[model samples]
Target: MTADDRRVARYAAAAIALSVAEAALPSPLPGIKPGLANIIVLVVLARHGWRDAAWVSLLRVLAGSLAIGQFLAPGFFLALAGAVCSLAVLALAQALPVRWFGPVTASVLAAFAHIGGQILLARAWLVPHDGVFYLLPLFATAALVFGTINGLIAARLLALPQGKATS
Candidate 1:
């Protein structure tokens, strides 16, 4: 395969791997997910571009939802909303000076926006009960924690030589 083709394959593989990792994480909350795969997304965004990362994020959610048997459920909608919001954030971030903040900061903000959008969408379309409000703190905490970790991972990964990453 060509160099570009190899890079695309590697990126796609990382995205899928991360998605599976995220999906396998145990969740006590019904609507909350750890978003571990976002680490790979940030890496892809930094290394490749927002457009490529967007495609990876979208494919990860759709294929992941199907594999996890949530394709037909409202969770699919939540994932879609989160992915779109994340992509929008990444696109905007790309327009900004990279000197202001690193991948971790961007990842944190994107995570916050992602969860916020998903929650709003869910409340508006799927769950009308106010009980869902109780999960805000939990969701926020997860986003902060996971986003930080994902950002750190991305930062560390970006520091490594590209050839060393797959080793």
Candidate 2:
């Protein structure tokens, strides 16, 4: 495989591993995940680019879902939607000046977009009620807190010695 392909594969594997680990963690709410996998995506966006980040994110959702036996299920669709929305937002966020739009900002944007996407999908497929909106406050708070924490971790990893590969 090509170098970029290899990088994408490695990052995708790491992200999938994180997804599996987070899946094992207990959550008060069904959909509330720490999104540890996103840290790798953010780092890839920095070191690689949007395209590479997109590949890694998509692969993680697909492969991670299969690994967790969520493939082709509602949960898998939710994850796919979230990843697509997050990647779209991150692409736009990247247009902003890098001086201000770094890991944390990108991550926050991505997180909100991810949650928004999930809400939309859940409303359409799973819940089919306006009442689903009621959970936004709690989910958004989780998004903000977890997004910031993951962003901080990504920033630290990016700051490490170049010889040490986050991949």
Q: Which candidate tops TM-score?
A: 2
lDDT (10s digit) by residue, model 1, range 1-167: 66655665677667777777777777898656667778878888888888778767887878778778889688888989988987888788787778988998879988988888888888888888777777889898888988888899899989988775443
Supply candidate 2's per-residue lDDT for 21. 90
Clash totals for all models, in order? 0, 0
lDDT of 1 at 143: 87
Per-residue lDDT tens digits for candidate 2, residues 1-167, read 88779879989999999999999999999889899999999999999899999999999999999999999999999999999999999999989998876799999889999999999999998999999999999999999999999999999988887654444
Best by lDDT, which number?
2
Q: Rate the local accuracy (lDDT) of all candidates.
A: 0.81, 0.93
Window of ten residues with lowest summed lDDT in model 1: 1-10
| Residue pair clashes in candidate 1 | none
Weakest 10 consecutive residues, lDDT, candidate 2?
A: 158-167
